[model samples]
Target: MGGMARYDALLVVSFGGPEKPEDVMPFLENVVRGRGVPRERLLEVEAHYQGVGGVSPINQQCRDLITALRPEVDLPIYWGNRNWHPFLADTLQKMAADGVTRAAAFITAAYSSYSSCRQYLDDIAQARAKVPGAPEIVRLRHYFDHPGFIAAMIDHTREALDRLPEEDRDHARLVFTAHSIPVSMAASSGPSGGAYEAQLRAAASLVAGDRPWDLVWQSRSGPPQVPWLEPDVCDHLATLHAAGTEAVVLVPIGFVSDHMEVVYDLDTEAAGVARDLGMRLTRAATAGTHPRFVSMVRELLEEPEPLPCAATCCPAPRPRGAS
Candidate 1:
């Protein structure tokens, strides 16, 4: 355990979701926190979870990712989430008890933004503070442009395109979607700013190759008065329909799995829009447990120690009522 022998364990950090009906509201509360998401919005989101029988696919997705990852890396794989069960603090406590001194974290979010990157760092810091002798967590660098991620997405997109009507498959437009952070958050996303959108666009381009595509936003939780990224996926689908696009493949470039956001927002809401508009919309699968994405964890661990984000990078967004 000297130079080049950096860590004892591999931590998989993720945004956790509720696994049952009773856990929904508490989980939502954990997510909105001081961000000032409205009560009405929370209620609406709660209904989304309820409609799906109060289970979010996210927690299971995390479990599956960790299960797939264990066989790939030599180190012990431990998973923790920001919001729900297997909480990061609890996971850290167990790691400490297990005699792990240091670890490399592979956060599920693959890009640089307040929510995606810095918040997870803050979570790790908070969790470590609560666990005596918590392992030093070294977060892996952003992997938006990693070949393994891009390849997984590319293959999924092709599959989605194939799901379209044969006459439309060859001409289907690729529509890449990601969660919409507030405009202010997007403005201050990286060292300089705008790194979130830039990295996402880069990934989309790699996945798209020569195919025509557009990057749109989804799962916007901000209040109506405040602007978030847009046009929202549903609205974008309408725009595509109006533009005479015969078919569209929705690629959720923002998420790594088919969680509630992908399930409720895209498959349910956006897909409804596509149906109403008489348009064909096929959603590409997220890179959940995809072989290359699973292997990307090991690849990241094998790379040189990644530099941490700058202190000024991805500053937190102000609460809705803040002046």
Candidate 2:
């Protein structure tokens, strides 16, 4: 019975972050529950959160986006997260209590990957199982190449380039970044494989236009032995600096907000590397609350309802102990 007209609510699903100083460890625990990230590595990630006073700006960003969407769409908006407070299960409970029967889910991540795509699917499935009378959730299609999303990134990329010296602005290399999943996961991302990298490349290419650019990985969490995507952003920056490049613009095409990964990893760590290298580096803003992006959400809802991904699409990565 569910078609385009069957949805009763809109859900903005996101990768949640801690909002206070005390929620760091628990939030990190939720993030790395399984998958065997070592203790030292977990502590290091915890430090990244603690360094920022234990607050990740992601939750607030989600709230801001929803607030912006409230007026544009008629459906009641429900927010949920995969990692932190306002968990998906809790949100679904609220939705069921509110008598919502069906909802359209708009995940924050644009590209495809295990963590970005399938993991969220699994989260939705688990949450629905936990909450009785939970609404059927239809996830919106991936908008990596959506015109509105591209426009927002283009605007931000231009703004970031303008921040560089005029002499270097025109020649600044566009360095696009995305989260680094394990090599195995990256290889098996889509129905066939390699959808994660392929989508990122497509997005980066659109954002670059005539400008020279490279796609790089960041915030890799697995063990050192496990190979993930190649050419880490920071390392790529160093490579550019070594090659006599004068300036660069970092576009975070993979994410929709300036969460810990964008703030700490790019702004703090990578920017520090650029400063030491004397390379003028400016990071582009994400699509958070960008007018075009907000409009895009409304547009997605109006379009023909997106068909669900195949069960075989974006399969979960191989477990750590599996041979």
Question: What's the lDDT for candidate 2?
Answer: 0.91
| Candidate 1 displacement at residue 59 in angstroms | 1.0
Error of 1 at 274 (Å): 0.6
Poorly placed runs, candidate 1 (over 4 Å): 1-4, 320-323
Q: Candidate 1: lDDT of 186?
A: 89
lDDT string, candidate 2, 120-237, tens digits: 9999999999999999999999999999899999999999999988999888899999998898898888889999999999988998998999999999988888888888998998
Clashing pairs in 2: none
**Candidate 2 wrong stretches, greater than 4 Å:** 1-4
lDDT of 1 by residue, 158-184 (tens): 899888889998889999999998888
Deviation from truth (RMSD, Å), model 2: 1.4
Whole-model lDDT, model 1: 0.91
